[model samples]
Target: MVTLTPLEAELLEVAGSVPDPELPVLTLRELGVLRAVHVRDADAVEVELTPTYTGCPAVEAMSQDIERALHAHGVRKVTVRTVLTPAWSTDDISAEGRRKLREFGIAPPRTRSASEPVSLTLGPTRTHPSEAPADAPIRCPHCGSADTELLSRFSSTACKALRRCLACREPFDHFKEL
Candidate 1:
């Protein structure tokens, strides 16, 4: 594991505490995007962040939020760098984040290997969202039923898919595994 200096650790906590732009319910730390804080000088520091997905628009907002938070905490010349080399996986999301998402009427993504890239299929289009990507039955965040079916692959955001629970008859978003 990488060792951090005292100041870096403190800055990391501040930056990580910033709320996510899209999902206000979860912080950047819970989302698993805030990577590291490198103190270059006494007043200037650099922060590393990864987007939830490639070309994710939220990255810019997240960066600004982090910068604003650090600045309020007496940081100057803060630089939030976008890191994409290792990419991001849903598995990086903390358990608390998942619980929060579920509690907020969204289905949490199931655990998967971090190394596995999200797969895309080029099959014939179907009318129902439940036609493909048959990994497993998604549980409803409302009633906790395993009888939820996808309503649309695209929801409020690209990273989430819309689904409806058969048991509770409630519609919700599922954070698609990356």
Candidate 2:
């Protein structure tokens, strides 16, 4: 068995500070993207990551963030590997991640109760069958109102959707569940 050197341990610690490019509020760890960190020898570190979404363009930027973070900590050689076997879901997000999203002004997905209704009201005047509480809250992140509207099925960000808060009359992003 190989023990991680001080430098390697330090590198992982530093890497933990890096946040997801698309969701700046969520750290890689919070997002459950930082799967593993292994320091080989004294100068090289290997990182395993699982992308939030396969089509997410932020992947390259995330890779760069990891490398830069390790380099900033004096790790000369850093390799970021993407692992997608099990795939990512709202379930993988840590409690901290969910909290971060709330603080960042975005509602996280919701965890569905066995008796919960599948379809949710998107706005005061609109309804969508696609609405389902998976992990994050179904309420508005801004006004914390249950009276919200799903403006669009997709948002500018791949992982998010456009939503409007009826109470606050403000548009915000909602992290969609896979």
What does candidate 2's lDDT look like per residue over 38-118, in tens digits?
A: 887778889988888786687788889999988887889999988897787766788889888988888887655546555
In the order shown, the candidates' Cα RMSDs to the true structure are 2.4, 5.1
lDDT (CA) per prediction: 0.88, 0.77
Could you tell me every candidate's TM-score relative to the true structure?
0.90, 0.79
Instruction: State the TM-score for model 2.
Output: 0.79
Clashes of 2: 10
Best of the candidates, TM-score:
1
CA displacement after TM-score superposition, residue 133 of candidate 2 (Å): 6.9
The residue-by-residue lDDT of candidate 1 on 120-173, one tens digit each, is 778764434366447666788999887777778899999998988888899999
Error of 2 at 50 (Å): 0.8
Clashes of each: 0, 10
